[model samples]
Target: MTGQVALVTGGARGIGRAISERLVKRGMKVGVGYSSDPTSAENLQSEYGSDRITIHQGNIGARGDCERVFDEVINAHGRVDVLVNNAGITADKMLTKMEVDDWDRVVQVNLSGTFYMAHLAYLHMAERGSGRIVNISSVIGEQGNAGQVNYAATKSGLFGMTMSMAQEGSRKGVTVNCVAPGYIETDMVAAVPEKAIEKIVSGIPMKRLGRPDEVARVVEFLADPESEYITGQVYSVNGGLHM
Candidate 1:
């Protein structure tokens, strides 16, 4: 993967940060996209140097912002060989209590934002006859959480998009795959109450929360040049929680 170029959305923090650092260590030049938190982005740049990493700030929910970020990455690195659609947000509330704005905002960022980035990368990759796209989903999307109807729906929607895009990209030497991560030790998971987290961990066969790097390893595998045969598949990094 040395010398390859990749764009990782939400790459400044949490699991995205792990992914970005992993890819950079693997010898790939990465474009780190973040909506906020310039400090984290700056830290990554400082750690990896500009030669291996570039940071872009934008709201993935907006098509214009997505376009600008994508263009900036292309202009900086020449081309994108891999795209990791890891940006997402959660507005948790019971179905009845969830406001229209909350639902719309989640959908806009999780689903529409992914589409915008993937569409741009897909076109470019298909034309170039080679590329990889990895979408970050969640276990809640598979099991359907009580207070996360909107989030679950959007995450689950990635399945259809990934599979369909995989078929289309097949002949073009591009692959699309999804990674559904369980309760990992991310800021998002940390926000969960301690009691709730305990219950969540007990249910996992592994009896522990997953690590961001563990999920990043799967992503790295999928983005490898040798992973060409794999596509339209979902790799659950949930420690047998759902299997």
Candidate 2:
């Protein structure tokens, strides 16, 4: 793990932050990609050290950004063994009255962002013949949400891609999987209207939001060597919300 590396998108905060930190602690070099958040990036680098953690500021939705982030990881750590496609944005609205920009933005970041990062990871990982990719999807993707039509569509599409890539990657000694998390206790969830949270929790048997570290542990499991036999699967962290 000391020589291996993990590239995590949207790593400045929330689930991404925990994944980045966990990887770093595991003695793996981390390349964190963030969009429009220099302060968060700087803070992460400062905590993890610029030598061990390289922070790349760019939009995950762009191909160039994906290329640049992986390039830096290669230059800094020599090889990329893991990729966590966790950068995503949400534009919650009913399809009837949703803004066009909102729809485009959600699709761009949630769906295209995952594609760009995975494409880059595929290039490097396929070449190495020993790599892991864990995509961060959403429980809403599996069990559709009323107000998040665009976001749900994008995430659901990711699961299909995950299965397809897992088949392709397995032949090359690489594994591809997706992790669909439930309502996690992140700043984004904290911002959810309390009444809305109540409504959301009412559906979950757990009756509580999940923690960032809980999701991080699942990412760690996927990244670990023990999970080598596990691929083409969707691991849900939604506390029985979608089961």
TM-score of 2: 0.96
Tens-place lDDT digits, model 1, residues 101-200:
9999999999999999999999999999999999999998899999999999999999999999999999999999999999999999999999999999
Worst 10 residues of 2 by lDDT: 60-69
User: TM-score: which candidate is best?
Assistant: 1
Best by lDDT: 1
lDDT of 2 by residue, 61-160 (tens): 7778777877877888788899999999888888898999998998988888888888888878898778999999999899898989998999999999
| Error of model 2, residue 125, in angstroms | 1.0
TM-score of each prediction: 0.99, 0.96
Query: Which pairs, if any, clash in model 2?
Result: none
lDDT against true structure, model 1: 0.97
